[model samples]
Target: MARSETESERLKRIAILNARLPRTRAIAQGVLRDPKGRVLLCELSYKREWDLPGGVVDPGESPATCVEREIFEELGLSVTVGRLLAVNWLPPWRGWDDALLYLFDLGVHHAGELDPALYLRREIAGAHWRSIADAAAHVAPYTARMLEVAADAEHPLYLENSEPGRTR
Candidate 1:
C-alpha cells in the first residue's frame, strides 16, 4: 500500500503549490426530488457535456451559499441548499496539487419550465431534469456515487473517495 501523507502535511503542500497555480472555487448543487426521484443537471459550456448545475464559488462566499447562488444563476430556479454530500479533491497539476469540490444536496423551492435559449447567455449549453438512473450514467463515477448516496435517503454526506490528492 502507498504511504499517505497526514492531513496537515497535505495542507502545507497544497498551500505552497496554490501560490503558483491559479486558484479557483466551485460549488456543484444536486437538485434533489421532493418525494419522487429526480434531479436537475446542466451541460457545461467548456465540455459541452452534461453536468450538475454550479459555477465558480465567489470570493468570501460559503459553499452552501455558492451552490444556491450558482443554481439560481444558471437555471433560473429557486433551490434550497442542503447538507454537504461530497468533497472531491482533484489531482495535482502544474505546480498546483489540489482542487476542492464541494457537492451539496439541493431542495428545490420552485421548479421551472425547460428553456434552452436562456442558457446561451450564461454559456450553459444544456439544462434539464433527469431521473436518478439517467443522471448516474451521465456524470463521472465519483459524481455518480454522490448521487447514489444522496438518493438513498438512508445515507447522506457519504464520502466514497478518501485519498486527498487523488482523482477517482
Candidate 2:
C-alpha cells in the first residue's frame, strides 16, 4: 500500500512556489538619453516613483530585445539601444528573493509622435527627458549608478563579458 498526500502538504508546496517566483524574476533596465543629453524617466504605478525606462526580460527574450520593446511600448518612439551599462543584482524587496538587472545605454531618436494614443497604451503616467543628475536623484540607488555612467559620454558603459562595440 502507498501513502496518500494531504491537502495541507499540497498547500505548503504552492506557498513555496509562490515565494520563489519573485526570486527568479530577472529584470533588464535601460538608461536612455536623447541627443540633447537628457535621460528619459517613467513614473511607475506601483510606487509612483520615477524611474529609468526599462523592465523585466520576458521568457525567451534577449536583453536587447526587451529594451527595444519596452521603449516602443512606453515612449512611443523607435529607439537605438547602445552599449551595455551595468549589471545590478537586486536582492529581494517587498517579499521577493532575488533579481538580476541588466542595464543598457539607450539612444533615443525622435521617430514618432508623442500623443494620446501612445500615452493611453502604457501605465506610464508621465514621460520626460530630465538632466542626468536630476533623474539620478529621483530613482533608486542602482539606477543612480547607471545614470552616473551614462552621463559621461566619453566613458562608454559595457557589460562584464561584452566585447568593445556598440550594439545598435
Best by lDDT: 2
Give the Cα-based TM-score of candidate 2 against the true structure. 0.67
Residues 58-84, candidate 2: write the lDDT tens digits: 988988788788868876666667777
CA displacement after TM-score superposition, residue 160 of candidate 2 (Å): 12
Please state the error at residue 62 of candidate 1 in Å. Answer: 0.7
Flag regions of model 2 displaced more than 4 Å.
1-23, 110-113, 120-122, 150-168
TM-score to true structure, per model = 0.64, 0.67
lDDT of 1 by residue, 86-129 (tens): 66554454474455677766764323454555454546767656
TM-score, structure 1 vs. true: 0.64
